[model samples]
Target: MRSAVVAALALGLLGACSAGTEPQTGDPAQATAAETPTMLASAPVDLAAAEPPECLSDGIAYATVGQDAGATTVAWAGAGDRGVLFAPQENGDVCQWSAEVARLAGAGYLVATYDWGASGQAGFQAALDVLKATGADRVAFVGASAGGTLAAGLADDLSAVAVVALSPPAQYGDVDARVEANQFTGPLQVFSSTDDPQVPAADSALVVRNDKTSIVTEVSGTAHGIEFMAPDGYHAEHVRGTIDTALSQGFGEG
Candidate 1:
């Protein structure tokens, strides 16, 4: 069993830490939208100069859409032919992404992964590269934990695909930070449990969209990391179901 125990700094804004402070490895470099030169005022992305592509995980291949001109490098499996992308909850590395890649690959999807740009905004920047590089006929964003935040921020970018976020923290910005449901243009299906102490269910309730049906699963006695850290893994069904639904809608699959 590949242990999901990654460097503590590898996860989402909320998964590994408490309110206000986010855990990051290496020197903490902060960049605001203004400091981003490659990005234009017209788009949330710059798409001008791309970060040089490199892989931080073994077994996961990385490639960019443009020749380092201005696109995110996509992390993907070169083998499977199914159209699927799995982003692990910010629990750590491509740890969970690896498992899901194997799972969906086995289930017959040409599964791919995009680096979440694990170091800083550079990581998020890489994630954007992965998406643009994919050349996917249809796509879906399956975000786990902190990965969900990137998925949410990429909603406009991923508009062509469906988004399935597991254990989406109420606020990617803060603990007490209430995400006005308007924060996302979601046909978003959020996964949660009653036993979760790390992220409260109340937060998800606030951000849930009233337009599409909001399905919240309150699993008793379960906490965060339910699928990756469990025996029966009650969360897997929700995970699978959400991905399947998104893909079906994404590709117009029946």
Candidate 2:
């Protein structure tokens, strides 16, 4: 059943990609010489030279939440009442989540990604507000490393339907994820690598509340945090597929 759903998603993505490439119904031979020259001069240039391709591609739209040093830039796409918010690892930005964002968006969920700004948790709250303002009622939080810690710590407080943490530590700076995990009763999933030097699987497991709805999975490798989500990372397909399934079920879309 999972494989069938994945295949259907792939077909949908292919259809979306091909939808814009239908052949034009005009003949160049009938174009006037003046109109031809104007058309040539107005052709679009390569946008990659001026901006990151991920920010511009995949139908993404950008918006800013908060102000001043607390401001966080958000990139989002897709549209639905079900949404997913991605939080980046420490010292990273939303660009790290580009692939995941596109994947979730294509899956028919409104997906949003942002960098944690100076306001810390407040910035993330603002991003959540942005999602809510955009019509998302049921949302999930997915984060990596420090961001994962934040997601675990804030999920219950923010009323998130689900939370997924990748290589999260039991505690991150001022946030105590273990305590939050103990308090949150919603579905929580944590992923870690057995050999991750920054945070071992045993350490990541500490964030599990031991509730029937919570689970921790340890894959054999040294990759940490967002590395697990990269296309070529260890067991990336399995990890991503598991996350997608979890989100679908948690958000009542399964």
Candidate 3:
């Protein structure tokens, strides 16, 4: 577990404190044709020229897209042509500073996160569109909570390099992760804690595809969503290790 101060700060923007701030609008993907292309023209942030805030990790360049759609932020690190899209928990904004997201950026992979604008699948699809347009040789998905369910449900359509879902439910609205998981053949990593109150370990297990490449890591702590990947939070290293391993093994393999 993180220290009291760290835990409080992390939780502040994750969900508990981020209500009503999220935009309630139509899907950004459905924006005007002119707006869609502009959002996809992602440019890299020059980290060496400008200093990143203390909240964001060093070595990673930052950028944004989908402002017209719903504001999608992207962080890039390393030299790999592969990219990873990170989806936050329910009610969490993609623009918020997150150490876990920063770490993924630092690992030398192109990373993207975005606001869904309450458009559900459309919002998620919009984020994926931006990632694919960036010219990345390969791409993957990582999400927590509601974002996790979305990732699992759309993995097949996205043709993701792999997927890593933390504390996710088996379904989100009409999207069933279990049904979608059965069709995905890539490496899938699902993390769950037996102590999580919001999502039971059993519910998380419902996503298991029972394939040789699928893995469900059950831990003892109660951290859910992005907290599960916080450096100072419980199961942080495990989350990082899983992503690192999956990216190395699955990224750009095709």
Candidate 4:
């Protein structure tokens, strides 16, 4: 019964794509199940068959990273030597970063986002491989919450030019983000809300490296992860502008 339901959903998504339907947009937390795609347990679903989200409608393309059971769905836009890879929060999906991805791509930077599925770090690595293969020699990592933790943990090893973590915890799963941040020498920005119910601002501060280039910004509300960057987020303008400046500095465009 479950498999049948999954198949029906997949077919429906494909139909929507074929019809050139415009994807609904708003807060990712409020996105309906139909607007978000999930992985199938048995086989990889061809997410590319669906129309890219409305934000990606301009010139974005979709692809599958990795293969077989490890395959993950990814969407990308723009083409340049500099790129940005977005890692979504644990419960979030690619659409969470749609607006930001479109904005960055419009600024002439390659941008990509993906569904993590069950592959975790491996899935993220594969997405990075896609970015490299598509002509990005320098890439930055941007993530939210759990994804933020992973981004900081991998930045040093991945040679990321900069990393932005929105409401990241000190540790997530087995990854010790604090340690990883300590080891990273590049620019790092960590943002969190003072009253975030999940992880307190102080806890998120633990992920900030001791280097001069690292800093943590705490806002007044309880918005978590990607919420800080949402179009209607409490501190959207300030947060977004700060991030833009950081990205420019990291990419040598400042």
Estimated TM-score for each candidate = 0.59, 0.75, 0.69, 0.77
For 81-152, candidate 2 gives per-residue lDDT tens digits of 787888888877778787776666655666777766675565567657656655579889988998888888
How many clashing pairs per prediction, in order? 14, 0, 2, 0
30-96 per-residue lDDT for model 3 (tens digits): 2111101112222232111122334443333334334454544443333235767777777775544
Model 1 scores worst on lDDT over the 10 consecutive residues at: 31-40
- Which digits, one per residue and each the tens of the lDDT, describe model 4 over residues 219-249? 8989999888777666887777766877887
For lDDT, candidate 1 versus 3, the one ahead is 3
Error of 2 at 217 (Å): 0.6
lDDT of 2: 0.66
Among the numbered candidates, top TM-score falls to: 4
Error of 3 at 217 (Å): 1.1
What global local distance difference test value does model 1 have? 0.45
* Error at 240, model 4, angstroms: 1.2
Per-model root-mean-square deviation over C-alphas:
14.0, 12.6, 13.0, 8.2
Sequence-dependent TM-score of model 3 = 0.69
